[model samples]
Target chain A: MNPAARSADGSRRVLLMLLLPGLVALGVTFVLPLLWLFRASFASSAIGAFSGGDWTLSSYETVLTDPFYWLVAWNTLVLGFNVAVFTVILSYPIALFLARTESRWRGVLTALAVAPLLTSSVVRTYGWMVILGDQGVINSTLQALSLTDGVVRLTNNSFGATVALIEIFMPYAILAMLSGFGRLNTQLEEAAAMLGANRLKVFTRIILPLSLPGVLTAALLVFVLAISAFVTPRLMGGGRVFVLGTEVYNEATVTLNWPLAAALSVLLLVLFSSVIVIYQRALRALEA
Target chain B: MTIRTSISRRAAVASALAIGLSLLSPAAMAQDTSVTGTVNVIGFSGVFAENYEKFIIEPFEAKYPGIDVTYRPSKNSAETLALLTLQRGNPEIDVALIDVSVAIKANQEGLFAQLDPAKVPNIADAPDWARLDGDRAVAFSQDNLAILYNTDNVKEPPTSWNDLTDPKYKGKIAAKLGDTRGVILLPILTKLKGGDYKESIDPGMEMLKEIAPNVSTWEPAPDCYAVVQSGEVDLSICWNGRAQYLHDTQGGKIAVALPKEGSIGQTNTIGLVEGSKNKEAAELFVNYALSAEAQATFAEKSFYGPVNTKVELPDEVASRIYGSKEAQAAQMSLDWNFVADQYSPWIQRINREVIARY
Candidate 1:
């Protein structure tokens, strides 16, 4: 071999050695389980059939054809989209403030913004239940002030789960947006104002465009988390809401139908893949 | 006081005799330095698991110090079944504790071994109702299904199952759906409205559809017990034993009633793994677990009715459970083996037609 080829081969070997551990870890944790799941998805769901029983497409056929499964899928996507939009809307101001603020309390405020992430989502979901339950503080206060004749149903439904999911996911959006705002310059806003642009116009043209990547990234993060969320929906939806995540859990654990659960999971993976594809296209279009 | 004393005295005497007799034969079991293998077991999780470990497992370990008993807890019976089915033949779990319905499903898959009566003699004292899965598994505990109402909100406690659909309770009932609770509800509602659940859950489905609007939450947050305790809802269709225990723990804020039409019993069963290598030790654990002494202790502590009829509880404790004949009479008959088949299909039906539609 030529000297150039020898060096290239050595460098390739070094790269492989560097990447080997991560590749092995991913293979063991991710790839292996996925393969097992694929196998399980095809396994027979007939009476007393353990995972190795027989290979068939019945599980996939059930998931694809069933209107109930479609309803769950729709619920999951709707939750994801709503959570993403709301997270961005709710978190943008917090991120902007943290990025631009010079006040001494900015650090403490940022800390406060990120503090809820330290607590488990399960705890926060329960905290929401305490606030939104039928006889919870909101209803009690509303009744005491005579603002309402009867207690409004604020919880154990889709609305409550959505609200809680938005809150639970907001911190992630804020952090992501804050990181994206690293290159944002104050001079641009001042320069725009000097050129006779209004405050809203300056923000719309300069700031929003600069932070569009952040907003998109944050939305993607929140959307993915929201779709895959298990505890919050299950607890808050009160078994009334059937999202893909909860449906998967119900099939695997409650029904003890591993094949159907695996098929549902495979569908969730397909959804995630579609999201990644959309995200890439959107990012590419933005760059273009 | 007298009952407690007499029970304790008898228990003490029985233990003394048991220990004396344990060393001789296959009939009674004891351990020495030779029996040192671990018996890995999986059962219930949460508070019940902690208590079971402390009350039953800890004592079993103390009695047979050389042999180690490792207890792994799964979230629920279905999870256990998933694990057992996955690890079939090359079995890691020496024994399992699961709900009756799940136990039937697992046994159908050949996950559990047939119990030898000679090895575990305590099965003789248990009721015929407790023996299950063709002697592959036997019930150890029971928690009956019933009505639970918040004492503060409910001026009049519910007296009948039909009260769930009463106009006054519109949007005030916390109904637990799916799993054993939902499975039990379908059949009971079907029977109440003159239909058989097994033949067709349509009538029960219709009954639930009627009750759906009145349901404040088809799924209660945390659980039905917590919602009732916090006055989130005035009524819950839940297991009686937990509610009865909560009644005392939570300062009489809630009350459990069997309702005029009666309710069903949810039995928890224990069995040996079919391919367990530690058979002798596992059988010993099962035998010890089924003893009147072990049963009495768990019953006194857990509020769950003991399956071993030989275990005598105090009037205060017994009154709370389906321990007495009258309370047992109120237990509506259910074929849990049949439920093993109906469970998933019924949940899907109720979810789509009833929970989704309403």
Candidate 2:
């Protein structure tokens, strides 16, 4: 072989060596667990089938056939979509303000945006429970301000759970958009302005279009998270709201129906993966 | 695969990795051991575990100096069940403390060994209802479902299940959601309406629906007791042991009431693994756990109602043990298996048709 080719082979070998540890770690942690989960999804409890003998689709059948499961899936989708949209709508402007400003106030705003992410999900959910409870701060404040006659229904309802979820997950979208904003080329905006275009025109024509990738990425990230969220919905939704995550929990734990739970999880994984792939493909097409 | 196919697969894998990493911190893995070096026990995270550590664990560890004892605590049975499942083949956990219903479920799953009654002679002293159950599980402690109310706010707390459903207490009442205690309430409610607590639950659902709007909130844990103690909630359904603890700790502000309509109770049971590595050690531990001395110590330290009839309990504990010979004459325990089987469906149905209406 040529000396250059020989050197290239050495570099390739080094790169492979460097990547080995991560591959092993991922295999052990993610890939193996997912395979186990997939196998479990097909499994039947003691009643429906014998102890791990046949490859049956009864679990999937039950999940597909059940109206309640469908309701849970619908609720999960609706809640996830609402949370993603609300987080983006609320955080985009804040993220923009932080990126555009050079003052200490921008730092303060950024810190405020990310503060909730520092706390554990359980602790934060409990905090919202206190804040959004019927007799909690929100109701107490409303009552004191004479905004309502008595305590208004808040946290223990679907709307309250949505608001709490949005609050908890808004930082993800904000940080995504913030990184995109950080990488934005300011020269193009300056050129548009020098050409007599107003700030709004520059933002709409030059900035927003350019930042679409980041916005889409943020939405996808938040949506996936919101769909799988278990704690917030279980706590804030007052045990009334049936979402996919809670449904899986109920099936696996209470009913002791592992196959049904596994089937539900498989469905969720397929749906989630397909959405990400389709979205990413669309983004690639738009970029091209 | 083709180069393009490989590249795309890599991209997908990379993105998935990024997403997972960004979302969650890697959870610590439990150490896997081949040798039965020590006995690790799994249980609920509460006064029960605290009492176990004080009375049983401390004494057992001291007595068996050669062997070590470890207690792993979890908040929910779902998590505990998951943990137990993970330790399935290896059987790292020697003993597990779970609810009576879960013990039945675990027994069905072959998660527990057939406990030898001969080894644990103390079990013979337990009530016939607890022992006669064909399952391998043995009832260890009893918990009563009662209404805990603040004395200052409510002049006269409800004495029976009828008093609980009173329209006046609407919007002030709190109860658990999707918990064993919460499910137990259904059968109790059904029983109150001259209906079967076992077969049918429509009446109970109706009762819950009627009180749905009035439920200020449905708490998952006994956090309501702290709220009631602080005067945040005037009334809520609470466990008897937890209620007793709260009443004792917080003073005369809160009071516990077991209504005349009769309430349901749950027994926390113990079972052994089917293929336990340390069969001798596990049997010895279980036998000692149900002994008269252990039961008395548990009652004194943990405020749990001891199941060992041979043990002489303090007056406070005697008053709380619902199935005690004296207490059983007045109260009835709904069939536990019936409660366990129906609980999931009833809760799911209520979540859909009733609670969702709000």
Candidate 3:
């Protein structure tokens, strides 16, 4: 072979070697199970009929055609979007604080952000339950201070549960943004200032544009977490609210409809993957 | 120059430490499968884990020295069912100690390995009432749903399901929900309104709605005992075993009573997996699990009534469970199949109507 072709072959082999472990892991753990689940989704409820019981689209039809499933899907999307928006809003300021703060307090700031992530979701949500419940610490304090006449209806409310999720997932976005800010060079801002540009102008033109990557990363993380969050919504929302995660849970566990649940899971996976791909494309376009 | 180098070195060290921490977490958790020859049974919590291990696994492992047994406790039947479904084909579980509702569903789904009663003689000792279709499963223990109330909260514990909805106890009650269908309340609720459990949905739903506002929360876990123990709710719908356990551990704050109309009783069952490698061992284990000694141990520890009639429990244990003549006579048991079938719709409706509004 020619030298260039030999080098190309060598590079391909090296790439394959590098990618082998991840590919094998995914194939073993995820791909094969998903394939089985896909098959199961088409299978009939009749026993020993693993195959050839009419490969119908009935399961997918059930999920897509049903208003209940659609409602859950819409709720999941809304929850994801709200979480993403809130994470960006909350984490942007926190990221700015971490990036601009004195070095001594950086550890403390990071610790405060990371503390919630380190704990179990169930424990954190349960803590929220105690704080947000009727006759809870918050309500009791409010009452004593004459802020309200009675204990507030907070524990079982959707808005309260959403706030709890936002609080729980904020750290990831903030941390990612902080790292992004660290990588960002302050040269453009300094150069802008040298030209007598105002601080606001310098920031808007330089820092905001530079930090877009990190902000995107944070939003993506929040979206993924919010969409897949089962425990927080189940426990704190008290099953009064429904989402795709809970719907999948109810289908598989409560209703014993494996095919339907699997179909729903597949839909979720597809939606999540599509969103991620679109996000990356958008990020690339913005960068260009 | 030395000072600048030292500061840079300190920064390098900090970066290394942060990177190390981030990398270590996933690596630490990647040690996922270290299965070293053990039998794993996943199911709900209670005396089943302890009794099964003590009487069944330990003895079997004694006979077969190399075998190790692991018991995984699930919070509820639905969770157990989910876990089983997830672990299908490559089941991390060898056996599952599950409720009748879960077992029946599993049986229908071919999740369970059917047993030959001729192969498993201990199946005979299981109460006929506890058997499902005389085929796939056998009862190990009965977790009877009894009326448990804090004596201090009421002058007398209500003798019927009707009294629970009385205005006197408004906003001072709690109830079980989700997979815990309160099958025990079905018969009593139906009989109180002069109907059978199957035809009693309207009345039952009405009954639930009356108490819905009063119920502080629809506890989906057996840990509802802790709620009562904390004096958060004056009275609650609780299991006999839970009441017995809490009363024993924390003190006699809660008293368990079998209502005159009779509550629903549930029998927790054991069955062999359909494709078990060791059907002989599984049946052997089940036979021993249903033995009188095992039953007594389960009764004493879990406060659940034993299905084995041959087993004689201690007076206090017997009195606390559902095996007593009065307790047995009063129990208004319903068809578990009916509950399992209708449960999804009923819960969805309840969630939409009562729980969401309340």
- Judged by lDDT, which candidate is best? 1
lDDT of 3 by residue, B1-358 (tens): 9999999999999999868855864432232232225556676676556656675566556555545666788877767766666566766666778888778887776777766777667667766766765557677777777667776776687766677788777656667555455444545565667766676566666676777776666642225676566565677787777677778777788777666665566768776666665555555556666776567777787777777878877676766776356655775554666766765566666655566566
User: What are the clashing pairs of model 1?
Assistant: A238-B219
Docking model 2 quality class = incorrect
Q: Worst 10-residue stretch by lDDT in candidate 2 chain B? A: B27-36
- Model 2, B180-265: lDDT tens per residue? 76677777777667788656888887777776766766744227687677666678887777777767776868777767665566
Q: List iRMS for all predictions.
A: 2.3, 3.8, 3.8
**Backbone clashes, candidate 2:** 7
Runs in model 2 deviating more than 4 A are A46-53, A102-112, A182-200, B1-40, B57-70, B74-90, B132-135, B220-222, B251-254, B300-303, B309-316, B321-328
Q: Give Cα distance to truth, residue B274, candidate 1, Å.
A: 1.2
Lowest-sum lDDT 10-residue window in model 1 chain A: A45-54
TM-scores for every candidate against the unseen true structure: 0.87, 0.84, 0.78
Off by more than 4 A, model 1: A1-8, A46-53, A102-109, B1-39, B50-70, B121-131, B288-301, B306-318, B323-327
- When sorted by DockQ, best at the front, the candidate numbers are 1, 2, 3
Q: What would the DockQ be for model 1?
A: 0.55
| Better candidate by lDDT, 1 or 3 | 1
Task: For residue A206, give model 2's deviation from the true position in Å.
Answer: 3.3
